[model samples]
Target: MVSTIDSPEYTEDTFISRLLTKVPTPAGEGFAPGDDAAIIELEGVRFLGCADGLIEGVHFDLGTCSPADAGWKSLAVNLSDIAAMGGTPTSALVVLEARLGEADGESAAQAAYEGLGECARSFGVVISGGDVVSADRLALSVTVLGELPAVGEALLRSGARPGDLVCVTGRLGEAAMALATAIPSGTDHPWAERLHRPVPRLEEGRAIAAAGGSAAIDISDGLLLDLSRLCCASGVGARLDTAAVPRPAAAEWQGSGAQRVAPEQLEKAALGGGDDYELCFTIREPLLTRLDELWPEYGADYCVIGEIFEGSGIEGPDGRLDPAGWDHVASGRRSLE
Candidate 1:
């Protein structure tokens, strides 16, 4: 007999909560499932581990994105998780599922590995062991491992407090625009690289942690939804200055190179678009001066967009901003954008 809890109507969040209840964390583990990565300690050293997967139809269109782009993104997304914890990525294991018999399958698989190798070299990460299997469509899963020297050094979503200033690194909305325009793989479109080959903000994450950031999360999902998760983790609320959000410049999306996006569309994209692997973090007011002094050394673009407060949810100038972002189950059922 099917229980009420097993109904198909459960949202992704509800399913995860129910699943966790059935499989509680081990007795002595250092961390649980809700955060960006799992933290574990061994011989006085703390480590972070996380996994992310990319599917051909859902994450990329094979006709639009090259195999190399897919490979780079598969690892980069996981690296963003490590970055969220303010840890340096040390190694990774990749699981590749290839359509071996297809005409371009072998070549695509080779190019994908080349891209993965290139990304690993750039980040100084070791390509650890993994498995490969034949499948109907391409899929890749990556597991990244990282380390922190001390127990309290790794940043956590639960660390944010009221009066903390919320900040983000780099400009947002380019990836969303790129997707909307359906720019080809090799095009010179300004937003194309952002969607195809995103740079994980590893150095910037470390800088934020070193400068005493209270909490941090990578913006793999939309800014508003991810910020809501951070606030919920910390048991606080947030107020955002919509004008302060750093959106992509109009010139970047305008002109003959790519489809011109109006200012209002850009604003919506920045607010709700996902796949921009930038870091969103919170710092106490007292440490703002220190962050200002240290941020430049890392060559990161950042801005203060909001602040934490004592409450239950996120609010913008017009009042509570809807918690809308890329939800796997919900998006599969309908369009979010």
Candidate 2:
């Protein structure tokens, strides 16, 4: 079967589809590879596990991100996956491949470890042991393990049903703006800060799960792509009110580069940009009021920007949006020039 995957121009989606076709599904498991994390029950205790990778060029540019920030992002990305499942992260394993011959290699490596340590301490996550090796470029892979609260259930992407309200946490597009402006260090750029230091909506995820969220996904991919995945998982469709999507403030985009981005393009970036690390979720119609009442305690603002219905794909006020985001294989090919 592996030999049968013969497309020379294969995509990440194609690779994943072929792999899933070969892997055997775990019996009676409610969650599997398609979700943000794998939820498993052992001895009546549920656990969530997920892994994320950060490559030197694909995920960050050394000129733009400090080693510390890179380390923080590597771990934060995995933490967001756990948060999406409504789990509390407990421990992590980090696999680091450091370039040993670079002039700033040692110092950069130390800074990255410092950043990882600080982030782990902030989240109360312990760094279990991991492996390290020499490479031409720096890369970090993080695997996080988390446990669901006793009274709360894990939020699965398949739980959303018809009549559920589509929602999101915090404002979108700031990260996109950050990438667009590429502000220099020490510029006090809020969008740059948002791009480098994304906050995982852990508390909000727990609150949603406790309040009976129908489904949830962390917005690591673009809002549209992630929401589309949730809809597909639940066998439903989404109707988005494009006007209701909470966009970043215009002030956040002020700079020389801001002039290059049209106002309408900002909306496109907000809808399709990746690395927001916010939460996009669904709540059954009956629980919308309770979710609103409990929002203040979660320390984040949420907006209902759409609704779930019986159908096949996502639709917006302007009609259907292409479910596209940052694709590694496709992006890699483009970067070769």
Candidate 3:
């Protein structure tokens, strides 16, 4: 079943319904926050479009990051959205909002934009022009445009079925651990790089799409939260084994005895961590063996964590799994530390 949230000022359904009714998708699907990106078909060409933002206090702190890190992250998140849609990113429009008169200065702002441009070029994308706004705080908005060059159709959240196997690419919790460990272990730590510089799983996403994945979503929030969103979109349920989630080893992250984080904490971070930027997708039962045999070229490593079911909600080791982590509008965040 699709989930709904109601509040005094706004409701998710009312706003989404109004948008869908008033603004038709034409030949493509309409907007949904967690759908990753939208496909727009115009003049027989299908393009993927998505926008993501990062604010100074909410997403990052300037004290803990350089202007370059902020810029890289802004564009990186948007690119992850494109990857989730199973498309190849071609170009991007970047919006920068900054407090110009602040101590950071014009040089700092220029550095940030340069960082974004470098990231775009590295990922084989062109950085088109966008507006710059003067504000009290720093904010970056990135809109990426991509195309389905090889894929027959864009992978969507609503495409999941009851019998599909739920899979995730690469390891989880490293990003959350990066965040949790940085303060005590120092910013110079290797894990900190995972938190700051995230690689979008574009190749893996394209591979999944080409392999006929039933549904796909990037794990920008948490594995459990994003998985729940996918289940809700597909009107199905999932039974996940927390033990199956891939977590970073204690020795790998624990640089010293004093910096050691608990094993359960690491597992928690893997299951319900944010900003991993990995892809969580579902595949048909028949395709798993084939994918496993020819796995080298599909890009990053992946693992099967669960399966889609016929009902609503997600089941975890303890029972009902709460899809709570990295809420953008909500001030409180799930803390692994």
Model 3, which residues run further than 4 Å from truth? 1-34, 101-103, 183-188, 256-258, 292-299
Kindly give the stretch of ten consecutive residues in candidate 1 with the minimal lDDT sum.
328-337
Candidate 2 lDDT, 60-100, residue by residue in tens: 88898888888888898888998898888999999998877
- Total clashes for model 1: 0
Q: What is the C-alpha lDDT of each candidate?
A: 0.82, 0.80, 0.79
Q: What is the TM-score of each candidate against the true structure?
A: 0.92, 0.90, 0.88
Better of 2 and 3 by TM-score: 2
Best lDDT goes to which candidate?
1
Query: What lDDT tens digits, residue by residue, belong to model 1 across residues 186-241?
Result: 67876788888888888788778888899999888889878988998899999999
When summed lDDT is taken over every stretch of 10 residues in candidate 2, the lowest stretch is 328-337
Global lDDT for candidate 2?
Answer: 0.80
Q: Judged by TM-score relative to the true structure, which candidate is superior, 1 or 2?
A: 1
Candidate 3 lDDT at 303 equals 91
Q: Give the per-residue lDDT digits (tens) of candidate 3, residues 78-166.
A: 89988888889999987888888777755567878877877788799998879988887778999999887385468888899998999
Task: Quote the lDDT for 149 in model 1.
Answer: 22
- Global Cα lDDT for candidate 1: 0.82
